[model samples]
Target: MSVAEPRRIVLFRHAKADWPQVTDHERPLAERGRKDAAVAGRRLAGTGVPFDLALCSTATRTRETWKLAVHELPQRPKTVYEERVYEASPGELIAVLNETPDDVRNLILVGHNPGIQGLAEVLSGSAEGDARERMTRRGFPAAAFALVSFEGSWKTLEPGVATLLDYWAPSE
Candidate 1:
């Protein structure tokens, strides 16, 4: 039997956002956020993980985060802006994953916290070292990302089915 290509899911929480914006969705990334995003991008580029698609939240912060992160990527991946991911719950995020087309193997999700953090927590089957410890301690902080590998298709993904490959948070 031919080996199945591992479905990699990269969960990226938008970098730190400034509070000056009038609305939550209108908020922009802070100075530190830009720096952190660039660093995160460089790190991602080093991994040589070529993403096939990215589903991002419509919020300004999320949009900005994706924009900056992709700058360091070797190749720009196809991106879709979905309003539903703006503040999606864990279940909602799972639904989004389930709806992904089978053709898209490598995926990236750039969104907000609580929801993103919640999704990462529930889906992470196993992790090791300081990364796991940091996740448990601080949860998903701004500019933090969790890389997971799933053996099954996106449609079949469920809690504890994927392994957390890496968790990273860029410092200011």
Candidate 2:
């Protein structure tokens, strides 16, 4: 894609996790999470974004979430299980995104919050229609995702550069 072409980032928070005896990183998705994840995937497919890549956290819940969600998409994007995304802060998440290959025009990030939520808020300089309001009001709940778009190279992705195009939560 040309540098001037718009790039889209989907910030997706992992689904709710079960309280297993395993480590936090090993905890799997809850029953509700399983159902919600598929629903999220269907909704994402509905957007017709044609995602090129998925940057997913390495945590078990996040991995599980992606597995279920991707099944609902028309085509699966290349996935990278990134450890840096696990428990990362908003700035840290942005740093990870900055490393994304310029060839990727549409990217989906499956991780945890408040980093996902924080990233959504930090990068969104503005929003379309009621997107910002809905995102703020609904909050970034589990299985929630926000779509943001910007025009620039991945290296230039920074605070306040993107526009919040849409937001979705399983509940809504």
* Count of backbone clashes, every candidate in sequence: 0, 0
Q: Write the per-residue lDDT of candidate 2 for residues 11-41, one digit (tens) a residue.
A: 9999989997999999999999999999999
Can you give the lDDT of residue 32 in candidate 1? 91
lDDT, each prediction:
0.87, 0.96
Which residue runs of candidate 1 sit more than 4 Å off their true CA positions?
A: 1-3, 128-130
Q: Give the least accurate 10-residue stretch of model 1, judged by summed lDDT.
A: 1-10
lDDT of 1 by residue, 87-135 (tens): 8998899999999888888889999989998888889878755667777
For residue 111, model 1's alpha carbon misses the true position, in angstroms, by 0.2
Provide the lowest-lDDT 10-residue window in model 2: 163-172
- Note each model's CA RMSD in angstroms: 1.8, 0.8
Model 2 lDDT at residue 68: 99
